[model samples]
Target: MADLSSNAPPNQIWVAVKKQKVWIASGILLLLVAALSPDQARDSLGFVAQSLLTTAPYLLLSIGIAAWAVATGADNLIARAFTGSPVLMIFLAALAGGLSPFCSCGVIPLIAALLTMGVPLSAVMAFWLASPVMDPSMFLLTSGVLGFEFAIAKTLAAIGLGVAGGFIVMALAGSHILHDALRDGVGNGGCGAAKIRNPKTVVWRFWNHGDRVEKFGKEAFKTTLFLAQWLTLAFLLESLMLAYVPAETITSVLGGTGIGPIAIATVVGVPAYLNGYAALPLISGLMEQGMAQGAGLAFLVAGGVTSLPAAIAVWALVKPRVFTLYIAISLGGAFMIGLAYQGWTLI
Candidate 1:
């Protein structure tokens, strides 16, 4: 009566997948068009090259900001002052988050630091919710691609998400909502949080520390590489969409100011959004194809908040309830903002 399943392989096999997703995707895309003539293949390569070129400026900008943020330890320093009234702390954290140059991945260490330092969960929630949406670098790039007004609106929306998420988390304090947030090794200085030191001293004597220089070099390279991979994927996908997806089809579904289109955009954004930098060019193309402004904005917000990488980072640090609430606030805020923007356009 030996059970056959006892000697079977473990159901969850941990596969060590390489990080060459862009290369793999590009290879598959080329294979899909392998039947094309040489000239068509050349044209397809040209499209991808052009897409890279189009995103080059933003890529450079993002690299610079990411490098500076890491070197200065500015984000962690900002979170050190989160000991005030709940409302004020939330506002400060959210504001600092909106201004920070870190992406969702970059913000994880800072969030861990705040939680470990006993900063209110509400304030940390605000920063965690807000930091991914916009930063100075993103603002400039968005302005260049989507227009100044759109950039401004999106920045405001980022801050708004922080404030709203802060208040809601604060209101739900003392319930099961805030329980068991700091999981094992999450906030106990495990996420590579920065040490607090005087900024002026660090900046003035920056070259004296060989260790920091080495760390900075590694961080700079890592940040740049990450951006290149995601952006390449984004550019390739956008090129395909432009070449294949009909403009009328996009416009027909996403071009309206009605609640239907807004809701659809929000839902689609959760899974479809790539990165804030990549979303710009895609959003630009969608707008050219007659996407409504409100819908486009909704998509950006939803995607930023619910991006797969970002969500995974948050999930690593908090319990299931807190993670679900994060998503709910992001979706609700995105939808409400879209509706409000659409209403304002009529005024």
Candidate 2:
């Protein structure tokens, strides 16, 4: 008998079983709801399914492009190019982060590596803060769902956040405040430096190396699965919200350009927001219901910066004071941007 255990990961098995359970539970819940209220169940389920279909292509393409970038050693090239003056490096790091297609979780290992490589904390912080806000894949999808102006504004906001965070950290450079920041000096190393064996033969040998090919395939597939699961869950939750939550209620609360509304949006966003990929449709729905553009943007920025996953990753790697500063910069920058946008629109 072939030993199948060596062929797949143990966690994968658990994940598969958990997914099966989710499907089973969802089916049973749907059946029960149908038994109780057939029309409501039908509408909600249909909306959920539609939402899944709508976002599938973007999610797939984003992960695929991101995976390819890693496999081709392009991300490494970008990471290694951040050596320069503080201002220049900070700007470049922010730009790279905006362009790189990575979530907060995905960027943690790179961050560790960069720090270990002696990259300035300022530049590392710049990239760390910027990368999760927007990427090529997210930009395309956001442009499609929202407007071009909104997408452009988001990209700028991400870079701006990175710049602000980087400069702030630079200012606190010699202070004892950030002296105890790094909790760990290394990461799991799974996402460590990408090594290109032969630059000239990379194209022809890309598909020839069995191990490399396997690695890329596994990564791409895993990414697809991870994103699809989140997207599906988010769509389902959105469907329920749309069905149960009154549109007028959301609008009345978040429709204003006042500091109060923007502040609420930012604070609420820290806990309420999900992954960037999952939050788009929900944000869109809220916008359609009359949410202010400034408030919506603030919510996205704050959540992207201090999201649970991202915050946890940072907390695990850094000390209390550094984490506090990270949160402060993110929150403060988000509010300023939102307020500025509101002012721009008024003028």
Candidate 3:
């Protein structure tokens, strides 16, 4: 007989012994126990509902914006426009990213496309940091959920950090590093190699290429599939955090004198993943339970900046050192902003 242990796919092997069914049964039993145990079930249910509420709007916005970018090829155009000065390019890229509706995951592919199209690394880095925080959808969500003041503060902070970080990276690393990092893939001979195709012709070809609705449907499906896997994992993690981690735990750990809250919040947030929309309810809960504003803001920024999917995408494109610098700049910038916001609030 074949070596069934080695040959069997994990899923198949698990199912062969009914382990999958057993696991599901055990999970249901535990859920039932949790439900019957105390008020924890009710709290967990409330948390889950709140989490969904906070996340849904941002999720919709991300999908819509991603679809729009793919359909119109606006992402490429913006990246192409930023090829002049690395510093200026970074600012423009960050600005564009801030305005666009792509989430951290969507931003990664878009930035990759931009870099592949010859956009500077500084610009790409700026976009990576800015897009999640500055996008219109996220801004609107923040305003609706967190109020106008916080929304404005978040937007300004995102833009400031993006610009400052980009400039710092450019200054420290120099333009040559960006050029060299991009040399192998983003050189002149790559995507930009095609002679300037006529704009009108391109438009006509796109319109004429297959059934427009069908083409759009296909693209949307592909994009959704790509996002669903990552987003689902993020959502699952969010649920786990809500279910198990008490608000008081976070407050107790992070809530303290002077920028300590900000530091703790930022640290907690670095590993967490959630759309700003999804995070609002959690933040509100934390705030209600004594989490400081600055700390909350820190969490928001950290989550936005250090998403797993975005980091993976960046790693694929740039050198490890460059990627590390991007993360460091983003985290430090977020920490400073969070601290400033908290300080201003106290003053």
RMSD of each: 6.4, 4.4, 6.5
Tens digits of per-residue lDDT for model 1, 88-112: 9988878877776654555666667
Residues 67-136, model 2: lDDT tens digits: 6655554555565447789889999999988886553455666666666656788998888788778888
Q: Clashes in model 2: which pairs?
A: none
TM-score, model 3 to reference: 0.69
What Cα-based lDDT does every candidate model obtain? 0.76, 0.76, 0.64
**Candidates sorted on lDDT, descending:** 1, 2, 3
Q: Which candidate do you rate higher for TM-score, 2 or 3? A: 2
Q: Lowest-scoring 10 consecutive residues by lDDT in candidate 2?
A: 193-202
TM-score of model 2 vs. true structure? 0.84
lDDT of 1 at 10: 47
Q: Given candidate 1, what's the lDDT at residue 235?
A: 61
Clashes of 2: 0
